[model samples]
Target: MNFFKTTYTSKLVFTALVIFSSSCSDDYLEEMTYGEISPSEMTSPGNVDRAIIAAYSLLNGQYDASSSAFNSPASNWSFGDVVSDDAYKGGGGTGDQNNIHLMEIFNTNPTIIDIERKWVALYEGVKRTNEAMRLLQNSQEYDVALKENRMGELYFLRGHYYFELKKIYNTIPYIDETAATVNDYAVSHTQYTSEQLWDKIEENFSNAYERLPNDQEEVGRPNKMTAKAYLAKTYIFQGQWQNALDAANEVINSNKYSLLPNFRDVFLPENDNSSEIIFAVQHSVLDGAPDNYNGSIGDRLSAPGGPFYSQYGFHRPSQNLVNAYKTNAIGMPVLDNKNLAEADFVDPRLDHTVGRPGIPYLDLGVLYEASWARDLSTYGPFAPKKRIVSANSPYQIKTWPYISALNYYIIRYADLLLWKAEALVELGDLEGARAVVNQVRGRAKDSQYVMNLEGTTPAASYRIETYNTPWTDQATAREAVRTERRLELALEGHRFFDLVRWGVAAETINAYLEVEKTRRTHLTNANFIEGTHNYFPVPQKYLDYLASTK
Candidate 1:
């Protein structure tokens, strides 16, 4: 069965099981309910399978356990994109989801709802993964080989959850299946240093890489290469260039993944699990859920307001990002804060990535107008186009919130290539890094350009070229790789984290605000402080919860 495509029946069953199991106490009389199953009785292979599916379910970041859907979206649109120079919190007004607006301006506090809810959602993922592992470990009848593979999946998943927590919060408490009691789960965030935490997270991926098979029968399950890619990404974040390069090369030489022929096809629902995708949070609609929570529910607010889309327009593209796509006469990127006018030659990916005014938005018959944006005067006239599903696609759910079944990619092949490129740049392999960057840019250069209505003309002055000359300078090569990342993976929610990891979040964002404040009045007070804004504050409630345990 397609584990991710299943209904929410397993989730409900698993939740009830967790509640029932946790409620048992020694103070109660020893009595057995006739119709109910005890925790021990529930430790079967089938239930373990259901629990694992429940763990997989949380990858979409739509847990009903705690948190509003948008507060902890799987896409990290607010935390990763809006908080950076990439996007703005676009909606009816500043008052609408003002918490995100606070985040956009880098004024976040420990008690912000988004911060707390996201922590809860990610921890919930860890809890579910550990619960599955706990069940599997206690089982007596599961096949040995299958059990090993399933454990590998759990390790990979737990690593992913912790990885998200680490990147967002920096130093978080690490818990595992060994933490059986309530007290065990109440460990402090300060128990491990930041570097140690990365090591802990890396250990999970290493275990996964060791145990997982090279290929899986299921569509969404990660294989050995997936774990290796994550391991490489982990090393990149830690500045372990040699280790990162080694792991990245392992995945690269595997010949298992490749970029899609057309860049635009990568995000389409039909290509959700294509070879380009290393791992994605699988989503489906019309799966017997009345609310359609199984779809891209967290990103529902991002639908560009128009005739066919939901009116709650959020995650609008920034003018800074739009300008970053501009190219010079030879199709090279115009770097170092150069603003490009509307008529400037731009990379073709911009049309596919951002819904600019007068551009055709996907399969919609009409050209994307300025009015397609909600609160255009405040957020800007641009809307996000990459994550959105076409109106005519079967994946689109025509309802109050236009949630789609498009998968949110956790790691795409292009992202891995960029990671390897970053490592090579750091290791002083400038020529090698240049070649890897070209592999990504080359795809854009050769891919089909975005076409206009009636397929009669080019959407804009599309121009993109790969690096042809040898990179003699390391700094230039590094900057070139970083810029290419923005162009290739702009609105997919990696921009802020990337800047932070590169130690340029403060300088980059403050500079962005200086220029952006002039264009958009909302950013007049926005400032990014280096020491304070490097990572989000650990949620105060969690700290309070830990103190109460003490």
Candidate 2:
């Protein structure tokens, strides 16, 4: 028998038979299968709910720790931040998490442990989601609409998993309920073209949007708008401008979500499930959270290590990224400020995003110093801040101070606004696009900057202004939207992908490395070759696994 069949059948027979003779037969109970129940026996609504939760559990991408650096983290900080111009591999040195270091310099290969670990972790999510889907499909206990909704969620999760893989590796295997075992997961990544893969992902989101309810009582559950935003994102990535615009318009016009009053509040623990958040991976600090799977492990690895917290300083921001925040006296970006040491006027969002020297770090009242960095010389003086939780927040996991239950947003409304602006710009609506971009900038304009201990004065020369005049042309609007995304969403793990999709990764990153080399000597070897470095090499173990089976 097949493994699932054999295991399940054995369980059924074991529970049905009794060891005692006919005298004891009268006392024998026709009890339910209490242990090792097969999929057939696991048909109750309660059991199906458990399986659905199991599918959602992998959203945080936590598995029992085996390796550190390349372990599959859902956050994609290493790929999105560390390898991009936004950050450095901020740990000890090149020898530390050497796999990531190689990636930092564009020297990645299939043999790297991070490659293998990331591949395995994401595929594990796929496997779990697929298993849950298979079980749900076989279950008859759920009502029709309820089953469709649950199945839609599985589709979204699967699409998200495949989307990550597609972005990073370009070509990847697509698996679902049809493929249920280890051998089934061994399909080749070359089976589908890149466009074909994106189509498959889009199909999932479309199904999710159609089947999911407009509003869910549970805050964490994805609704129709959630899937629509993701669908818009997928279309945006593919330059399906008209499709992206329509999808974005649907979410925006529905008025289901809006930007938070303060941009900083979006990241805080107390303000979770705010109007801004469309879909976020819900984490919990409550005890017995299944090996802490519900907590964000990425924060622990990237947070301040020595003096600040018992963590590894892995995702430090680069000086180049810090300098990108520089604004002119007019409150517009000082696009060509090569000679300026300190910006005469800087964007307020900068202080919120990066922990610079002498600035007060959050509500801790501690002025951030250069010593906070694990290696100031290698990674530069700045530390990451946007995702860092304040020590005073009650939502922090008590036992694991470093591991936080803070939700990581998969899609937020602000992103929707910006992406809609991008679509408009692409469609020759420069003036129309300017209004949308200015809306985002206006939010940053009103938001408070970092303050002193007494909350009296701003930390840096904080100043930002929205574009008062219409964007003259498409090029200008495009640049404005891109810059706004960099400043507004910096270090929240979307940089590299943005750069790559824009077809400027080589030009932008290569330029960043050159400037970065002068500031920190470690990046002297870093260069972005156009084709080879755009997507990471497929994991070698996959090739080996397929070869062995062949």
Point to the candidate with the largest TM-score: 1
Q: Tens-digit lDDT track for model 2 on 1-550?
A: 1121112111111222221122322322122343566656676777776666656655666533332422566778888888898889888877888878888888888887667667755676677677778777888777777999888888888888888888888988887778744466667789988888999999988988888888887677788989999999999999999999999999999998988878899998666678999888776664454335456764567776535465567789877777778887778987762633653578888878888878888788788887888877787677888888876676655454366667788788888888999999999988888898888899999998888778899877888889988788778789999988888888877899999999999999988888778887877888899998998888765676677666
TM per candidate: 0.95, 0.91
- The top-ranked prediction according to lDDT is 1
Candidate 1: residue pairs that collide: none
Indicate the worst ten consecutive residues by lDDT in candidate 1. 25-34
Q: Which lDDT tens digits does candidate 1 get at residues 407-522?
A: 89999999999999999999999999999999999999998887888798898898888999999998999999999999999989899999999999999998899999988888
> So what's the TM-score on candidate 2?
0.91
Model 2 residue 175 distance off true place after TM-score fit, in angstroms? 1.5
Stretches > 4 Å off in candidate 1:
7-9, 12-36, 65-67, 336-339
Error of 1 at 444 (Å): 0.4
- Candidate 2 worst ten-residue window by lDDT: 1-10
Q: After superposition, how far is residue 430 of candidate 2 from its true place, in Å?
A: 0.6
**Clashes per candidate, residues 3 or more apart or on different chains:** 0, 0
